[model samples]
Every structure is written in C-alpha cells, then in structure tokens.
Target: MESDDLSSLSEKKLKKLINETQDVLDQLKAELKQRKLDRQHHEIDHMEDYFEDAEHNLSNLRLFIQKVFSEIRKR
Candidate 1:
C-alpha cells in the first residue's frame, strides 16, 4: 500500500498492520535461517543469489514497517 493510504488508516488499524508486518518479517528471517542450514546439506544449489535478494527485500520491508510505526507514534 502507498504511504498515503497507510497514513489514512485509523490508529487501531495501523497498529494491527504493524503487528502483521512484524510477523511477516519474522517469518522471512526464519526462512533465511532455514535456507542457511539447508545449504550445509547441499539441498539447494546456487542459492546465494536467492538469499541476497531475500535479504534486500527484507530490509525494505523492515523500513516500511518502521515508517508505519513512526506514523502511529505521531498520532
């Protein structure tokens, strides 16, 4: 969702969104950790690029969630 749309949400809704976003971030981190463990067993080939992409996206998601929380705090 756009920042404008996010800014328009009610405080309760915004808090809920922040919680959901955090959950997603946690899942992504868990997935990355599992991928690293699986790599030790050679379960996947050429996964470095995939992991890098995931990390980048996860960083962006974290920033977005931070922005949402910042907005919530401003209310």
Candidate 2:
C-alpha cells in the first residue's frame, strides 16, 4: 500500500497485517531451509555412489595384480 493508505490504518488493523506478514515470511524461510537440506542430501548420495564404485574398481585391480605376480613367479 502507498504511504497515504498505510497512514489511514488503525493500530489493530496494522498489527494484524504485521502478524500475517510475519507468518508468511516464516513459512518461506522454512521452505528455503528444507530445499537447501535436500540439495545437500542429494550431494551426499552422489558421493556415496562414487566411493562404492571406486572401492569395487580397486578390489578388481588388486586381484588382477595378484594373479599377474603369481604368473611371473611361476615363469
């Protein structure tokens, strides 16, 4: 509302408007926080997947190296 319009408001009416505005602000803040948390959770999930893949690749490499060493020893 314009400054002139706000000046005409009664104290009780202004108080009610302020309370409603505060409530809406609080809800928006909560939604923003939840979105941030969800993004962080998604990032953590991706990291876990990367770690699991790396672990599997390392295990396979270890077995291959051991087999190559065994063949070298036999020769």
Candidate 3:
C-alpha cells in the first residue's frame, strides 16, 4: 500500500488491515510448506530439464527459419 493511502486510514482501520495482511502471509507460508513437503526433488529437476530442451528446440527452429529465408532471397 502507498504511504499516502495508509496515512488516510484511521488507527483502528490500519491495525485491522495489518492483522488481515498477517493472516494472509501466515496462510501462504503454510501452503508453501505443505507444497515443499509434497513435491520430490527429482520431479522438479525433470521439469527444469523439459524447459531446457524446449528452449534448445526453439533456438534451433529460429536458425532453421533464418536459413530458409536466406535461400528464398536468392530466387
């Protein structure tokens, strides 16, 4: 929140907003902890490998397109 917006709130409202924000933060931390305990390290690594392979494939495709365009320009 911007300081100007916060400054406009009454003290009681500000305190309430703070409490609500803390509750959300606590809930998010708990969810993340649960997710961490549930996922295996190897599964995450496999996802990363898939992303790397996709990136390599796209790079190769870009080069292939450039070569094809270069050949077309000679006609």
Estimate every model's Cα lDDT from 0 to 1: 0.89, 0.94, 0.89
Against the hidden true structure, what lDDT does model 1 obtain?
Answer: 0.89
Write one digit per residue (lDDT tens) for candidate 2, span 1-75.
Answer: 898999999999999999999999999999999999999999887997878777688789999999999999999
Estimate the lDDT of model 3: 0.89
Q: lDDT of model 2 at residue 34?
A: 100
lDDT score of residue 15 within candidate 1: 95
lDDT per residue as tens, model 3, 1-75: 899998999999999999999999999999998888667665776797878777788789999999999999999
Model 2 TM-score (2 dp): 0.62
- Per-residue CA lDDT of model 1 for 1-75, tens digit only, reads 899998899999999989999999999999999998988667457678678777688789899999999999999
Question: TM per model?
Answer: 0.51, 0.62, 0.52
What TM-score does prediction 3 earn?
0.52
Which scores higher on TM-score, 2 or 3? 2
> Stretches of candidate 1 above 4 Å error?
43-75
Instruction: Kindly indicate the candidate among 1 and 2 with the higher lDDT.
Output: 2
